[model samples]
Target: MNKRLNSVMARVAAAGWLIAAMLSAETVTARAEAVVAPADGYGFSVGAPMTWMSRAEADGELDAAARTGASWLRVFIDWSRVEPMPGAYNWGYVDHWINGALARGIRVLGLIGYSPDWARAPGVYFTGPPTDPAVFASFVTTVVQRYGDRVANWEIWNEPNLPLFWGYLGDRAAGYTELLKAAYPAVKAVQPGSTVIAGGLSPAFAPDAPPTFVAEMYDRGAKGFFDAMAMHPYVFPHGLEADTLNGWSDVERVRQLMVANGDGDKKIWMTEMGAPTSAPTAEGVSQQEQAKQILDGLRRAAQTPYSGPAFIFSIRDSDTANQDNREDNFGALVTTDWQPKLAASALAR
Candidate 1:
């Protein structure tokens, strides 16, 4: 009887030690995450599209971004503009803009998308998905081959779930997944070190809406294609803190989706996020409030373990591009002339 009791006590003690070890491991992991927290990791999207910016203007914007503590610049590669004809290509504009930004010490996130006229179906917008995945893949190969050494990060397309961007492709995850599959390999073949980031996804409302588009991508085995995922948690009008259209917690939801698909290891970058100060909507906030929300959102993102660099949209206001356009107004951080906004002062390195 005593031998039996001794054996049971030994088993219990072994179980207790295992529990203690697990607790210790969890604590260690938590500490690691805390250490890596990007509390002050700030970046911004220059409002001007890369396609139209001249070399001088591009340099000024890059300088401004570097001065403002921005380490990363997100700009559209615009396949339509770069490759206007079937085989003819105009590498002049992009080459100048990219090289200029890099010279300013700002890392560029080359957003490659928008179908060239020859690559698109009839009556569809230029932003629509390409008619043939091969055409898009070829464009990807060319851009990466040209700038692969200087640019390490490449975001494939932008907001594919939105109607404005992908109305031609529809919300068919398989369609976008196919594009990703094609483009990912093309990038890898040219620049093996290049990081292929899934396009920044927009926050969509319904349950089976935009967010599901990501789940669909995973379902189609897109996990193996890219290095990281991207998102645009605009959460505008609603204070950056408020969970508008459920966007406030989009980072969390996206993480959960990644975990469920066995992709919990991947990082989610906020490629675009900001609240507008003017052109009031039902949920609009004042200019001062916009500044406050920007800080709060950055703090919140920093605390998240899986969150990567958060790029606030628009380093400067776009007064010339339809001043009343709310999106144009989203850039209240500075005037079109580069005058500082309240939010500009709040952005510390």
Candidate 2:
């Protein structure tokens, strides 16, 4: 072969090799991009405090909630609400909400709290925490039987550490633990696979977060009473940053408790965390940025190994609570005349 012809053949071979290399790189990049990533942060669920559901019938609220980027809805069940009168249980309101929510693909986490005045021992909050734990257990069992198939996650009470939620009980742990001791077994007996979520203490340094809360459970020769931990890390507007959420002592508070109790693998479900979104307050995540904070916090939580799900503190404003009500404004989404706020729209699923 002549030198020029040989050189031309060699150039063609090199060009083909270069083309093949480029094609391989492109394929690899495409493959890498194609791999589906898991949900680092889950979609937030809206909670409907018992107060809201108590006043009126459950309506398009569930649908509106589903649209607000929430895959779950927290509905607190008052033993009073369903069985407000002894021996005569009324399931009207609950039936409407649960069936409606499920029909629309919204998961419900039932928060079961406070005994009815009728069921309570006289003088326990004008009536009392059931004097007989078994009676409370029976109450829990009846509830489980009624809605067990529809609801998977059940919270024992709300902010058991707070006096208001506990009906001004002085002994938070003993009071809550006594109720749980009976309630948990009753619930499990009826629904063996049910997730019994111990109510979280309202985030406070006050009462110093009872050292024996979880410790005593273990100390009493108890083995893992709960499948997951519930935390009410109320990250106010100013404290919604990733660092702030990550820095909270609640993480370590429960983490050590779990490890000490030999339930290190147990997960954490942030039952409630929220902030106001009215305009842009000086100390809070603004309406505009609230969305950003939620998206960021959710993503961070998803990335955490043992984190389960988070239910934002509320759906609508509580009319019953007073203006000093920090809770009145914590409805991650607010409604007036059936219209949703921009923050709610931004986080739409």
- Score candidate 1 by lDDT: 0.70
Residue-by-residue lDDT tens digits, candidate 2, 204-248: 654535334666655654355677777766555556454443324
- Clash numbers, per candidate: 0, 4
Query: Model 2 off-target regions past 4 Å?
Result: 1-57, 126-128, 208-212, 220-222, 241-247, 277-286, 319-324
Q: Which structure among the candidates has the greatest lDDT?
A: 1
Q: How many backbone clashes does candidate 1 have?
A: 0
Model 2 lDDT-worst window of ten: 29-38
- For residue 5, model 2's alpha carbon misses the true position, in angstroms, by 89
Q: Give the C-alpha miss distance for residue 67 in model 2, angstroms.
A: 1.5
Task: Give candidates' CA RMSD values in order.
Answer: 18.5, 17.0
